[model samples]
Target: MVSVQNRRIVFSFLLLIIVVFSSYKADSECDFKAIYNFGDSNSDTGGFWAAFPAQSGPWGMTYFKKPVGRASDGRLIIDFLAESLGMPFLSPYLQSIGSDFRQGANFATLASTVLLPNTSLFVTGVSPFSLAIQLNQMKHFKVKADELNRAGGLHILPPSNVFGKSLYTFYIGQNDFTSNLASTGVDRVKQYLPQVIGQIAGTIKEIHGIGGRTFLVLNLAPVGCYPAILTGYTHNVSDLDQFGCLISVNKAVKYYNALLKKTLSETRTELKNTTIIYLDTHKVLLDLFQHPKSYGMKHGTKACCGYGGRPYNFDQKLFCGNTKVIGNSTVTAKACRDPHNYVSWDGIHATEAANHRISMAILDGSISDPPFTLNNLCRS
Candidate 1:
């Protein structure tokens, strides 16, 4: 009994409703306004030097004019992640100058671990800014942000929005393995992994308790493949894996990663409405090592800045820089002409080029776990 005009009007209304719902869904998926990072040197923008202030030149030659507290030559994975999100590079919480905490803060520090400072495994000695301390700092930052929002009359997010909508990233645990392996053996490290993962889980629960709903947890990379670890230890031919990496250490890394993934899965279940993503950085790094040409890397095993040594072109005493003391002799770590072709900047961290590739993969979901990519999580 309806007129033709009424039928057309109803069809147009239905179409408009569909378009509006779709737009709403898309907006909800990609509305991350801030990022908060917690970990060690791998993600530290400047927290270490803010506390120490002893680091010097040839460190930030690739990007910044001088050492900016980043352990690498240039930008890190955290930097690249922020760039992808169209957010400013996060300022280290300890940094006092030119800081724009409107996006969020970097609570990571060099040599930080999931364990408490009193633990025997913290090789760098007892640091005041442990992960627990960093968590506490985040709490303080939230309160300060709230105060600023109220006073300045700026349109910054409220405390609830800041934590709830922000992306929380953790790139830790390598130091724990390294310290433990050096102090205690591999078997002991393996046995202690449960406690380590438990601590990580506990930290996540604490953050969730404080309104953090989204998390991106990067698992341990191939620590055995690091030039520092490679040159530091004396290993038999059997100890080396096919990739010329330490076999036992890599095996331990795999075990730790597996346990970490399982733990995150459980944490995700326990925390309702939470998004916990376990990024497979190991797989990405291993792929780059196996097929360096694919990523435009010419030297996968060698460090870009070091005394060019055999097998891995890395010298333990002569780190990445113009000068270092090698067995009482002041030796210079000659920087490579083309760092872009190399995967590692120093003997430990990835070069900016490598970090960029890894970050792109993470954003595009190539290296992320299923059902959650950095892009999707930010949008969601």
Candidate 2:
């Protein structure tokens, strides 16, 4: 239990640290030279696909017109954000070919968790590129980039000064909760939240130590509302909320975000000249789910891809773009013709249209704590 004084400090910091945004592009004089991203598939440009040559297909069809590494049908929140900032899409740190890291590098990968998994990727399908590992990779990137720049490879990597001028974005932690939900249960998941939150905080501090002054830490989305979760969990009708999402799982996500926010608040006081903005991902995502029509989405909760029909369109085994022999017939989980109409792309991630809406909320300051946008970061 925190002391009353410590709790007060946390609350004050939240108000002080999180602030406003007027517009996405018009007020875009916020001159961030580059962006270094750390997260799961939510922001992964191509790390996982580059690492593992999976047999899956038909991703990135909406925008990229090919499998360009994102789990969604097209660009993610990170892509929209980069475009808003007038920066090109960040190249994945793991992708070796045709990737230009002069602007930034994306260290995020699919199925990545905050904590390092005990099992290997082959055994559990969880990414080995955990938060700590991403941190190490960032550290190494700085060292190597500096070396390359000194060795006349200026065009290959950004200048050393760009590190301090970059925006460090984190869209991780969702996978951490989702992967453990079925295995450990919500109560057990709650018990480990502090460690998870601590890892997130510690990563921020480490980035600050390495000259990262600006950060965008995102809270977990409503895990209960995810089609994958809804399909996987054993919840009766009474366990669901009005939107047909599991109340218990969302409650756990709230608890996790609360802890995350408290820790981020404290992080602000510890770092000097640092600006940390914790995105209220739960609120934004829940709001998006509640009013899909408001965002011009047709299916609020159903996934646009996957095997299972209706409700969620998610199957644990038969994933999106996957073709397998299911007892009698060879079934393929293909994407819907109108991917833009969906809130969920694969029952796990948001569609490109939904990603744009989320980015809009972030940049427009509706979900910001102090009602400020990236433009305010320039003032801070």
Candidate 3:
């Protein structure tokens, strides 16, 4: 014999409990449902390989045990990030067959530049899928995913609401500097950096307009310290820095980073509600090269999978896992016995060990601007 008020209280309590439990979705700890990634080879899982020729050899030997279209011998930073967030590995948007876009998709490609290349992909070896084109692809993906979900054919596609709740990440524009650094020199490359940064800013805004609220932007790595650049560009005695890195090129890299940080700052102001983070890839890599002991690395600047001997071990004509006919014999650029000891994987990209280090730095909030940790990206 409970009173009327007590009966109402019991009903209200039961109703509230039902509502709370009904909303439980087992979301990520960070509250991010999915991740939409855009970048160049640094994060390219299989875009270029699917769209064009696939890379062979020991590209993914270390971890994946086979060539998975990634330029690295194992996982990239993006892979580690997905693991950290408890999400499935992202598939390439261009990869049509056997792809699962239920978690997210990668739009990055090898040799991809933010700006459209002046020449064809074959001529310059730069990717045709620039940032703008990637954005358009994302727009189309959103609509198609929703349609598939409505049709009950979206088992492989993410829910329509995921596009807005997903984290938008960018690791591009490295080629924008690298491609021009050799031909155009630092001055000319510096002049066009604004355009590169603008393109990235606009891309973020576009994602935001489509309901994206979280973003993680990675700045350029230290190209001057890369074995590829060191081998490609011959520097005089005075041009080398204390660590034997190119002084002039590193100066230009610093300049580009400064401008990039400023642009991200402005973009953050414009998109007040969005969570924009700038991860310092440059600083993290430079420290790894300069202080290898700190990262348990031995061969700081040398490439683990390239031709040439000793100090850098990178050849301009011979890339890692490439084969060429020479003197009636075929020579392949093979990997080292101990890739974990080296920093550079193919003189251009980082080894999986190095990629892990970079991811840890960001997760620990050491190299990220505004100091956001992995567990909470949306926090101020």
Candidate 4:
């Protein structure tokens, strides 16, 4: 009934349709357009300097030329996550110094607390932008969108924008309890943690309502294990090596992380477009602490800066860059060699390499169940 030439033409068209369909299906399935981050120094790019200089110094010596305001040697959890996703490193929301937000921005500060009246006072701490404040910023972004539309400018995301096309990430609350312990004691954790955890859940719901569906929530790492706290307090050697964790602080971290996991599970059940995935940073970090050789980390309990004496310095005078005055005598913190290889437990925070590893793990889905790795997040 058909000629040979007509038969060939039909077959060619069928092949073309198959190719086009495959391409389109792939694109539609994995289309992530934006990444919004909120949290503290662990993920902060440069939020510290917005309100204070001391919050962003000495530690930022390796990757950055001087200090770009990060509390670490260079980079943080956010930077690693962006890099893993093949996205640009996000600029700090407070970094008016030099960055283009046409890409993304970090709202994390040094001392940000997740709770209202967040009872802590370390100079240049987390801003009042609590989780609620960060969501307000998103609302403010929408206001900017309206203004732009009125001015004949295109909106970053129009109302018709598809859900699950962006990823919302949070790495907050370490300062809430850490500062509490540093200031008063861990006993107060039981009293205030419930309120803080509730706020976290509320914040996630708000983001989901505001059009965020693909979400990643980083759980608290071992708070008792930070080099700053580790060096500050005298520890039982047996307890330290057995877990490489501080019992008192870690106990609080467990309670908070457990509550956080439950909160995320509830959010997943309630929201349609939203999926709250966890990054067990606490467990992974402890594993890393116990097995430093696997990640090429040599230092665990000591920081790259700060006084190297036993039960390391905590007073402001003996800080990483501060000059100490012992009977009018001055002393400065020490620096380490090859910071790229060292996992900072001190000089205020962890090293860039450490963040990169965590980011890679998170992107690979090793941090969550039914994992959604970085490649998976950006396939389309």
Error of 3 at 104 (Å): 0.7
Whole-structure CA lDDT of model 1:
0.81
The lDDT values for all models are 0.81, 0.86, 0.86, 0.69
In model 2, pairs of residues that clash are 19-372, 20-371, 20-372, 20-373, 21-372, 21-373
Q: Against the hidden reference, what TM-scores do the models get?
A: 0.87, 0.89, 0.90, 0.84
All candidates: CA RMSD (Å):
4.2, 12.1, 4.5, 4.0
**Could you tell me how far off, in angstroms, the CA of residue 97 lies in candidate 3 after the best superposition?**
1.2
Choose 3 or 4, whichever is better by lDDT. Answer: 3
User: CA shift at 96, candidate 1, in angstroms?
Assistant: 1.2
Segments in model 3 whose C-alpha atoms lie over 4 Å from true places? 1-28, 119-123, 326-330, 376-380
Shift of residue 170 alpha carbon in model 3, Å = 0.2
How many steric clashes between backbone atoms does each model show? 3, 6, 0, 7
Where is model 1 poorest over a 10-residue stretch in terms of lDDT? Answer: 153-162
Off by over 4 Å in 2: 1-29, 119-123, 375-380
Tens-digit per-residue lDDT, 206-272, candidate 4: 8777677878888888767667666555566764646466787788788888888887787788887
Using TM-score, give the best candidate's number. 3
Model 4 worst lDDT run, 10 consecutive residues: 155-164
The per-residue C-alpha lDDT of model 4 at residue 75 equals: 76
Query: Which of 2 and 3 is ahead in TM-score?
Result: 3
Worst lDDT window (10 residues) for model 3?
Answer: 22-31
Candidate 2 lDDT over 8-41, as tens digits, reads 9999877665543335434556668889999999
